[model samples]
Target chain A: MGGPDYAELCQLYARYAAALDAARWDEWPEFFVEDCLYKLIPRENHERGFPLATLMFESKGMLQDRVYGIRETLFHDPYYQRHVIGAPLIHAATAERITCEANYAVLRTKLSELPTVFSLGRYIDEVVVTDGGLKFASKLVVYDNELIANSIIYPI
Target chain B: MDGAEAVFPDEMTWPAGDVGRVPFLAYTNPEFHKAELERFFYRDHWCYVGLEAEIPEPGDFIRTAVGERSVIVVRDDEGAINVVENVCAHRGVQFCRERHGNRLDQGFTCPYHQWKYTLQGDLRGVPFLRGLKRDGQVQGGMPPDFKTSDHGLNKLKVATRGGVIFASFDPDVESLEDFLGPEMLGYFDRLFDGRMLKILGYNRQRIPGNWKLMQENIKDPYHPGLLHTWFVTFGLWRADNKSELKMDAHHRHAAMISTRGQAAAAAPAEVTQVSSFKASMQLNDARFLDIVPEPWWKGPTAVMMTLFPSVILQQQVNSVSTRHIQPRGHGAFDFVWTHFGFEDDDEAMTQRRLRQANLFGPAGFVSADDGEVIELSQMGFEQKPFHRTVAELGGRDAADSDHMITETLIRGMYGYWRKVMGL
Candidate 1:
């Protein structure tokens, strides 16, 4: 991958994060593949073979439903989030589709300048170069920090 | 049974039959609640500490507070569980200080002096004690008059039902069966029913309200039709006007019990939240609107029995819970909610329960409203200790009368309060 494709992919990843951390949440669905699978399963349940999840979203529709559910059904103090995504590491690339990974550290400052390292996770992404160049075909975020401050109200 | 309907003494007359005119000081006075903790919680009744599932591995220990003291619940190498004081026996330092962990280094080491003890809290080793001894005449090193037993962690009376473990400072409390009371024990037996619990997660809230009031809020059906109409608007539960709320002889506890009704039961009040909720969500899943997860729970006969003085055994439609409301004082309560599913429940069913979980806690739709209202109520009760609130929801007289969604049970709890405090 050269400058044009590589730079374009990084920008897409950045937008995906921005739409999330910036609370431009509705824009999140566009970042995912229509048939995307997203999940935030706890390690405790994983080890115990429990099927329950802190969050379990099967499709982009379910993920959309999550955002809608949080907005209407949940009551949380208003807060802001900012995501900083690093350059992408292209794992395997083809002309039409590219598999890449990037490290992300999201700094969430709620109501003040005292920003907290909300979550640090590595994003494993599969990108497709379609008419919409370098859109995420699949993004599986493996969050390093357990015990989120509250919950992931929006996609990362 | 209909404690709330009991008449309270007015300026006109004296009331009778263990029903009227109980003082509200128990909610505001730290002194009375403390004595009650000693007499009931510490002396003769067991307190719920933590579930057994919390510490399954050898050397696993978790710190929990029961009433006012910090207690360490540990699982030994032999898989035997013990409830001991969290305080270090030697200098009274906290032994297992962290919330939870595996202390496999030949027992627990106090962070202060590095003194070590077994999971059973026996003196495993005292750091540098033998080396500090002069000429094998261990004079002041081990306190020549000191018996190791004297320094071991003080233990509390403990019992378990299902995976739930309960302990008490009370030396002569009745058995777990008798302690829970027949009505409560029967409901608990049905809820837990000897099933191993798979903890989904824990959510904690430090509500600024009297712990007793927090329990009353849960048992009060009076609020649901008005405050939590969101659930009814979504068609989640139908509160039976025929249903009754009651409490035991000791009014320190409460039960919001609603009997399962046939589909043919007469209509009571029109569901309240129909217009308030976003009509869109009600349009999406009408099943979410009506179908409940727990088969035993028909039309959502959710009963939250606050086991007095503290633990609340909840039987919701999908999520079964045991919330240990550790009262910080007369003013605040630290609530630790443990959500569960039967170990035998299938993956799909478990998922359904977790999804249904959306309706609770602070993030939860149904729970967030109560959470806010309770905190406000706590704030209002102040500056007006003499001014009072009424518990009369379903009219007067006993025998569990009138509307099911009444403050009848709350009144019963206060009656029990007067008995315990001899007020």
Candidate 2:
């Protein structure tokens, strides 16, 4: 295939954000390939090569497990999260994969209070073109701020 | 006086030294928080600062807090570790601002006035001592009566046990091993078995609750099966498992240990059959839940050990971590979690620990509910400060237990808290 369309890849990012913002958690794993990695790590850990991540999923199956657990087992305060995704900065594009970076801010509204910026981070993604268009082979959500307020129950 | 009479009449008070009865005011009162910082933190307790592995080389330093005072733990030229106040003696400004760094040849230089100090916290030089600038221009300087030797950074008593460092403001405080007690020391040594630690990462969480609540959470072994349904629903923890609450002789330190028994593996099916335990979930990658047993640890599968004032050594399933509780105020505290692994861990072993990380950090499936519950408990105090929380699960006394369903450890922690705070 020819070089993946940058506009189409940006649209894929928009779709992923909307799914999470809508709390359509069941659809989250569909954004990634069958064998993929998704990790939400602090920038300090990312820079220092620390092995731990706040949220680490080595495969799409693990991502599905997280969604299932959060929906079924875990109990957290009732809150709604809205993810604002910025434009993607495409680094390299090929027939098989594409590397891109995008900035994001998550605003959470709980108990009808004002929406607060819960977390701000940049998404470093490795995208692949499959039968379903662009799917993330690897996505690293590196949060800029280290101090997490209360807990991060929902995905960022 | 009637039984309902106020304990202290005017000021806030504890009702008859009952470990089960914890007044909500203790968590919300500002006066109590101040007293705790003075009596429990500064005067009496040995607070865990950092790991010796963090500053292995000379001049390597990491800044931390002992209650509210900023402290710096550095390695001197001769490889001895020193703990000193981060405040500059000249102007009382914080000198070492970074969280951690290497100052190999050059010693700590005050960022504000260019005052210099050796790694051992001795006053080395002042930039313009005799009012002579770098260009040899004479200007105003310190008064002649000011002695440079007496103005060195204030040092604290430092101690290391199994590579973990602890510092105390009071030099006369008990030795590290004695403070931890023999029982706790054994478990502490088991956790930190002299293996070089590789910092996996950190999950720093700011909870809107009293610091004691965090400690109590670790001490209360009864809450896991009830509060965190993920543990029960996923067969990771069971109420009928072989678990116990072990306290030190003074009841100041405690460890809640849970071993995975054969019966524990079957508990999920039995629990899920009941309406309360039924939850719609299944792990696609169940390998993450597998516990690759460490050869050294012959104890329980899970252990949450509390070191009195502010440190917690935890081995939840396969994840090993230390939590440093920094009290922000009466109503809030920060849980600085340092996740670690043995330096000799193979690739698969490291990945297993990293994969299991989802089980217990700030955003962890099992740990996420704790922050919420603690915050909710803190919020409850705003409406009812005079109300008391009942910790009468296993009677009022604080002692060791053979069962997981007990509040003995929580009471033991508060018992220690009451003694240290002189309540």
The best candidate in terms of DockQ:
2
Minimum summed lDDT over a 10-residue window in model 2 chain B is located at: B1-10
Report the error of model 1 at residue A56, Å.
Answer: 4.5
Q: Output the worst ten-in-a-row residue range by lDDT, candidate 2 chain A.
A: A66-75
Model 1 lDDT per residue over B201-300, tens place = 6655566677777777776777775665545544455565345565555545556666444433333446343344543343333322233546545443
Once fitted onto the true fold, the runs of candidate 1 whose alpha carbons sit more than 4 angstroms away are A1-156, B1-43, B57-59, B77-79, B102-105, B128-140, B241-246, B258-269, B273-301, B329-331, B383-386, B396-403
Q: Which segments of model 2 are wrong by more than 4 Å?
A: B1-10, B133-139, B263-265, B268-276, B279-281
DockQ of 2: 0.82
Docking class of 2: high
True contacts reproduced, candidate 1: 0.06
Instruction: Report the C-alpha lDDT of model 2 over B1-423, residue by residue, as the tens digit.
Output: 323655333466677678888888789889999999988789767998988878888989989888878899999888999999999998999978898888879889998888999888889898767776666676777788877899899999998877788999998898888888899888898889888987788888899999989889998878888778777777777777888788888897899888876623446555334345754446788867867888867968888899878889989867988999899989998888888888889888888888888888889988989999999999887667767798999798888999977899888878877777777
Chain A TM per candidate, in order of listing: 0.82, 0.96
Clashing pairs in 2: none
